[model samples]
Target: MARNRILPIFVPHWGCPHQCVFCDQRTISGCHRPVTATDVTRLLTEALPLAGQGAEVAFYGGSFTAIPAEQQQELLDAVGPFLRTKAVGSVRVSTRPDTITPETLERLWRGGVRTVELGCQSMDDAVLKASGRGHGREVVAPAVALLRQYGFSVVLQMMTGLPAQTDESALKTAWALAALQPDGVRLYPTVVVRGTVLAERYADGSYRPQTLEEATALGAEILECFLRRAIPVLRIGLQPSEELAKSVVAGPYHPALGELVKSRVYRNRAQALLETVTPGSDTVLAVAPNRVSLMTGQKRCNINWLRQRYGLHSLRIVQEPMEDWEIRLQSSESLDKINR
Candidate 1:
């Protein structure tokens, strides 16, 4: 398989109509100056030569389509040469759902954008309102439908730990997002960045941030929503950056949060498989070699927990080629079972 890479151009808050309570665009993008079409061209020129053919140019950290049509085209047009030469795949941009329209989609399509990612933070109106997203759930379905109508690949982004967000509301958003059946989703457990309203709320105790444990537990369940529907989740938690680290005031922020959440999912599955095993029995789990660390967890945490939870005399993981979700029991005793 060709290794796919992302050549990102940070537009920052170029076209954002609102200062979302949780975002610090300058800090997150590390772009102190406004991004221009010239900047896009210069950045791409400097970067694309080393990028693989599978490299995808993505506009991150702002509403790309929400920007003026001429400006949006200018950025997209900058990618024209790379597309013509097959240096990279078509571009992808993240935008607010309400910004999506026939006019914008058509312009994007004409400019060679193949994927449209919507920041559909929540599907509940109250949660949306409390989060100050400036748009409601009503626009999401129509936006997704229009994207699909244009034959563009759709990716939706949702967040957890918003103001007034509840477990049920988050899950409902996930389930509702799954119904739209986008090509992929990005699940973010909110982090309170400094200099934002969320930060103020955190300081005042008006908003409580999720501990790493709490966030991971909830993140695992939310991830399962997409897993069950076979909708690919592109990310979990924020990608660690120096700026982000410096900006975080509080909340479930971790560098390897995705791995942590995946490990938690593994724990859940391991527990289920362990349930069928006899108490105090020696057992072995066979997983793909690449997944050893994840299944074993950081510092063998999963192994220790499983041993104690299942009352097993011994438990070990053996290398084997299998699906990521597959774990086969290789026990000398009668605990032979396989988790599908």
Candidate 2:
């Protein structure tokens, strides 16, 4: 397992010119107020001793580069001592794609910001406009290129089920992001939070959040595409927080959103195996014990889905000395019974 550590510091909606339709950063980030340099210093002083060596300090919940230069430097300076001592490896920040520029990249590079995550919600211009994202898809590619040119690791964040977004469009967006070759990706399925335009739209029946099942399936597909390209998926869903949970008015905002996506992937894998097995053949599926929960979904949803979809009634899953994500299947009948 990777040994890198991360300390997240929230800057709720900093440098935000206007509220996006689905934004409620205060609620989502669980930090309603701006953080000062002193706050950053105190947080690091308290967290550093507890963190592993080579930990990275992350600034999230706002457009870091777009924030005032003085304030940005103040926040960066607070962590400068630690970085110089090698107590912290580097700094990371999330910002809107449009907020990035050559100058911003240079400033961040000079301040030890080694990673930049762009909130490229969707790559479809229409979806971007409908979701009230000020920038279009065209803005993200160049931003990513610029960040990479500055020798900074680039992470792309995408959302599903946004206003005017369809599964096809979302897939297209994922493909575009893949083409950008970002070092990491984050998938955040849209959820309606209180005090956002989305909440009102939901109340008025103009917008509906993606159902849990739909989001899980779509997220699985998105994850698979990135995995195929060898891109690290930094996050699969929003980190659930008390503030965010209570504020959520609708949508698939499961606390274990990552687990849900894993379950869907397992289900897809199981189905693929079943398709190759002849009808009435008995099959025993083997997976790591720890993955049983994810393979079965929250409540055997995957198992039930398999039964209904493939007439796979005589299936058995056993724990094996295998990796978490891999599965093996053995058939009771002749090997020829394998349809494939």
Candidate 3:
């Protein structure tokens, strides 16, 4: 199914029973007000026209199914008129993995929810426990199976740098998530927002968040795992907001983190291709117009790295209309192309 522009509705921290160590939903989401059905109606009424008729309204920042039955229906019922008139094509919601049930899926299917996002933070039970995620790793596959059985698109979320998580452990988590065959994946490295339990841990030297460099490096590998499986990675890192910026005390927080991760992935591919090159060879790399920056990297870091690592006498970048992540390497002697 084709994806339209998403119209997001943030209901921060609503009906969340467990306060995960790394979460401060209101601060992270930049939404402080209590949301009602009226708010959902009024906001979408004005935004849907600009978003296009095929847009899906996403309920984010909380467990939509775990809330009281009446409250959940109130929100879904508010979308009734829009669904009828085709102002919105469908509904999507994010919730904790353990909260999903066949009954809940049935209700959502009846209410026009076509997609469900589960916050499956880690696949290691120890990591989950350390981070205060109450559910075990076992719940994830069952939840995914149930969602697919109900004919809903499943999106699995994973995190890195949680307490007791290593780079090896993070990659293991990625591998576990990939085996489930999700419709898409989202990667978020842990962040320490102020006023959360994580903040208190950071103050006393009990926890360490991944550095920007660390997160980017690990993210490149994690992204590769999904890409190899032909799974689309819908997003990487947190969405930036002035409120989120002000609230974060620490962690691998960059506004353009997804770009950094993608760049590293391209750089890795180029590095592998360059390993067979003769020393002092002049070369030119061609990529899609929109991917030039990602291929070149910030401050032309990828270019500089290749020159140093491969002993290239001259390196140049030229843009061309090409497939995404396609990089063609032409040296003075040989024309070598790598495609993915």
Candidate 4:
């Protein structure tokens, strides 16, 4: 199968200035220790044989640009040989919105970094402060502009249901991020982890994470906004890992959260399409094979939804022969007529 090979090197909280109220990087990242240059080199050596071309070395789980210059260079230098040998295609890293600077961008460029992802959690200043993000939305705008000026692909990461965040604020954040013209975005709804202040608040009834259904609906809205702007949403939820699962105190956490959101979007689209058909009319719906699961929804939710909304008890869903995102619908009359 064709894939964009990525070797994720987790740098958990290496240069984070403060522990955000909702952050326990070690738990969320599933890596408890900072990765050293030696560690990176060792990992690369072991991974290179298995990694073909088109592999990217990704530095994740911390504000990479905020890390000390010497340490940053050490890690970059360790990956340099692999890049030169064509074992790795490019470098990508994630950092806090406030961490980008001229010098930081220059260093990253020199190190052959091609993509920079910013953790711009929320655009509302109150929400940012409440979440202990240490920087406001104002900080992300210029950082995004500067990263673009430096010729790097920029990706903005946003969160919903953060402390002091509302549905309006979340939508506003998405609009504001769209204004920046980022090449990509990642939408992560807040998840309360053990040992975090958010978890304490959850215990005390002072905070609540968005419900799975609520989050999926919100994420669908956000996805539509970005899709309209032609911005790729690289991710939609926190990736599930054993360590991350262990750290969760409570919240809308799902191993297949991204798939769930996508399925919700598909169901919405399917419903819209079904609306064009006459009520109580039987129809057969065909979609791509890969999308069959999504169109069907989890445990036939989509099928049931279509049945209820369109009042069609004899709806049939089939996999299309050779198409993606192409759906064909036929009534019994058409099927009979075609066969005749």
Error of 1 at 315 (Å): 1.2
Error of 3 at 193 (Å): 0.5
Regarding TM-score, does 3 or 4 come out ahead? 3
Candidate 1 C-alpha error for residue 242, in Å: 1.2
Error of 1 at 153 (Å): 0.4
The predicted structure with the larger TM-score, 1 or 2, is 1
Order candidates by lDDT, high to low.
3, 1, 4, 2
- Tens digits of per-residue lDDT for model 1 on 40-90? 879888888788675788898899988988888888888888788888778
Question: TM-score, each model?
Answer: 0.95, 0.93, 0.96, 0.94
Off by over 4 Å in 2: 1-3, 288-290, 319-324, 333-340
Between candidates 1 and 4, the one scoring higher on TM-score is 1
| lDDT tens digits by residue: candidate 3, 1-340 | 4576888998888978899999988988888976899999999999987888778999999888888878889999999899999989999999998999888898899899999999998999999999898889999999999999999999999999999999999999999999999999999989899999999999999998899999999999999999999888999999999988998999999999999999999999998778888889888888899999999999999999989999999887778789988888776544444431
lDDT against the true structure, each candidate = 0.87, 0.86, 0.90, 0.87
The 10-residue segment of model 4 with minimum total lDDT is 318-327
In candidate 4, residue 238 scores what lDDT? 93
Angstrom error of the Cα, residue 301, model 1: value is 0.8
lDDT of 2 by residue, 46-91 (tens): 9988996679999999889889988988999988998999999999
